[model samples]
Target: MDKLLKILSENSAYTTAQLALMLNEPEDYIKAQIKEYEDSGVIRGYQAMVNWDSVPDAGVMAIIELKVTPQKEKGFDEIAEKVMMFDEVSSVYLMAGGYDLALVVKGDTIQDVSAFVAKKLSALEGIVSTATHFMLKRYKEGSVALVDVEEPTDGREMIV
Candidate 1:
């Protein structure tokens, strides 16, 4: 991986000047490289790792493991593309374990996610089976910690 990309992945909020300073390159060069990466599709959109648990109206998230029959010529690519087209799907990854694909889906409620699996995902062709696991809490996402800080409390008791 390129050094610029690595830095950006860790913190995309860095200015071109900051990135250039870190990489020991000129700001213009850094800007050009970033532009080239974006134009060539090397750099996708930037995102923040949000701690949704703190939000009151946060939607439910689930990890759906899928077992699918690979197509004759297209293999998993065709099915994966079709699955990615769904609006509720945040991510879809091809796995090498018991399941063929893993999907990260989000909905307003557990029932909403259930309906998506039963109606949309299962109804698709070549889909053999699925196992959905709801995310109860997130301790870490990417390089960020979602856990709340706790004040230190001494275990000693004071005697009068």
Candidate 2:
């Protein structure tokens, strides 16, 4: 009913009253719409994007490449499930080409990640090979976070 999504995307902490006032809509309407969006899985709730750069342990990050055979009966889901349960594994992706999976793992030291792979991951069965590429810097990440842009030429519109 209002620009609720736009408002929420920019500032997730905005209260229903604040959003309603900004969008010039009633709070009840905003609430109902948000509820519907949530139910439909359109709005997957709010989150605070942590500035990992400021974190004390931010320097520690690794990209672990994995080769896993898709199980006969269970398939990628089964293997992916085990990979995700590890505390060090931050992100997991079912990949194409040479590697079957790509894992973004983080820990205080390389040994932490290695132990996870050697003890936890490799031991899990179906895992073929693994190669780790630690990340030094992240140029961009996650949906290209919509910060203030002076030139709004609709890049999405133009590119597509």
Candidate 3:
């Protein structure tokens, strides 16, 4: 990956001037590159990884592994598109293992998520079976860590 892209991926909050300074390039060049990336769809969108646990009434999340019979001619693309249209679905991925598709969904409660899987997901045509796993905790998401470690009480910080 390009250095600029790597930096942006790790932290998209950096200003163009800051990125230019870090990369030792002119600000105009950095701006042009970013514009090109956005126009070409290389830079999809910027996002902040939030620790939902810290928020009150945060919804539950789950990963559903689905086995499906592919539609003729369309393969998995058509099914994948249909699955992604649901409002509860956050992500959909085609897998190479035991399942044909992996879907990440969010809902107000476990029961809500179960209902979605049972009524919405399973009801879709070509779906053979589904196994849902609710997320108990999120230790890390993307490049952000959810866990916060306190400073060493003994005055010697451990570095590993």
Clashes of each: 0, 0, 0
- lDDT per residue for candidate 1 within 74-107, as digits (tens), equals 9999999999999999999999978899999999
Q: Lowest summed-lDDT stretch of 10 residues in model 3?
A: 147-156
Give me the displacement of residue 141 in model 3, in angstroms: 0.8
Candidate 1 stretches greater than 4 Å from native: 149-160
> Which stretches of model 3 miss by more than 4 angstroms?
150-160
RMSD of each: 5.7, 6.2, 3.3
* lDDT (10s digit) by residue, model 3, range 1-160: 7999999999999999999999999999999999999999999999988999888899999999999999999999999999999999999999998899999999999999999999999999999999999999888888688877563478767878
**What is candidate 3's TM-score against the reference?**
0.91
Q: What is the alpha-carbon lDDT of model 3 when measured against the actual structure?
A: 0.94
Query: Residue 1 deviation, candidate 2, in Å?
Result: 14
List runs of model 2 lying over 4 Å from the truth.
1-10, 21-25, 39-45, 143-160
Against the true structure, candidate 1 has what lDDT? 0.94
Worst 10 residues of 2 by lDDT: 140-149
lDDT on C-alpha atoms for all candidate structures:
0.94, 0.80, 0.94
Query: Alpha-carbon error at 93 in model 1, in Å?
Result: 0.5
